[model samples]
Target: MRWLMLLFCLGLAACQPRPVKELPAVSASQSVAELYRLEREHHALSALADVTVTRQGKRWSVTQGVVIERPLRLRVDAINFLGQTLFQMGIDGPLLQAYVPAEKKFYTGMATLDNVQRFTGLPLALPDLVACLLYSLPPGVVESAQIIETAQGVDLVLAPGVRYETVFSSGRLSGFRYRIDDLTLYEVAFGPVSAELDFPRRIELDVPQSDTRVVIALDDIELNPVLSRQQFQLSLPATAEEVPLNEMEPVDDQTVEH
Candidate 1:
């Protein structure tokens, strides 16, 4: 019986995958209009704020400060709890120049700029993506919104490529579960986190298969404020290592290993 129990546990662990859920159905056109209207009413702005991202079962987490100056400039300063800066980047219009002050090293590359912009989860940029996430969107819409919902929330089986099972409400986002859309259990439960602002203040992502979880919270939002050009300037540390964005080669690994 003990051997059987151990086998069962192993089987379960091997069977688990990421989490993903889908919504029922809604008028995509109408939903888009509503989301756009919300942005206009809120008057989105370029600003900076503190961010914290946590994963499942881990007491240690990631804390960072993100600054956005608009049209296309983002600087993410990631640090540990000790107030030590881990990584910093100066993004000027799609260019990601990351520098490590302590290590005296830097790397330049192209990043998922569009993804970051679309999913700001903040009140920056003209068409806010977080607002869209709350509303119903067309599935396969814009090639990025993997899931869309018009009706009932969703239930997802765990599998590879699984996303989170999320239910958008008028309050804080919660019960965020992630698994493959095809494998999630037939039924799931969810509750609102808290609805203080138009955007999601808190989001809970659950991954039963991998036993992984993610919690995201947003605060200190400066909606639709004026920004100056100086904010986007790349203030590189003196004597720190530097690399040109074009110096790095493409990541096609089918060739020889450099």
Candidate 2:
């Protein structure tokens, strides 16, 4: 089976799927068009979010201050209670930088998927993750989607023979699924649409491929915030030792959410 590399921004995943329903269907051109339009207009955002990661029944949750922009830029500042920095990560262009306060170490490397997975346990390149945060399709997506009517809704197949499916329920995007042959790699289910932002308030990114599930809850989300290039830069204390990513080992880091 072909590995489509359908990884979403920051290891988005699918949830435990309910039974596929054979419900009545209708045309969703307007809603679908609006979704795409929103994507096209989206450029940057800065927000505070609650991220929870569940792996094999163990859960880790944290609040993060996140800033991200288009064309491969991201910053995630994970802090502990009482407003202390726990870990910080940034990606600008091809460079990835992170600082762990507990370890008093600074990490830097090319923003490759393997290196990223080693540090964050998220098997995704920078672009894919940035797009995932935009609530848009990752790069290399074939825009010519084939919409098939189902028992209850429609499935938008983005690539032929790729088994990457985008499902819409009642004119709203409900989830994205990737299945190769009989094996399903993931199904990312979206929470309810936010009335103010018109986006999913939460996303359940259950990436079984990595044995990790991440659920991202967005409460104070702002779109297209005024931000500059310097926003993606990571700052570390001078005392922190700098290390290359290739020399590091993978850690079961605190993560969970799409």
Top candidate, metric lDDT:
2
Expressed as tens digits, the lDDT of each residue in 199-257 for candidate 1 is: 44444433354343334444565555565655544567787877754564432221111
> After aligning candidate 2 to the native by TM-score, how far in Å is the CA of 36 from where it should be?
2.0
Global lDDT scores for all candidate models: 0.43, 0.70
RMSD of 2: 14.3
Worst 10 residues of 2 by lDDT: 249-258
Off by over 4 Å in 1: 1-30, 39-60, 69-72, 112-149, 153-197, 204-213, 244-258
Model 2 regions more than 4 Å off = 1-28, 118-121, 142-160, 251-258
* Candidate 1 vs. true structure, TM-score: 0.49
Best of the candidates, TM-score: 2
lDDT value, candidate 2, whole model? 0.70
> Candidate 2 residues 43-161, lDDT tens each?
78787877777776777777888898987888888887778987888889899998888789898989887666554445556776677677766654535667565643445566655
Against the correct fold, how does model 2 do in TM-score?
Answer: 0.79
In model 1, what lDDT does residue 133 have?
30
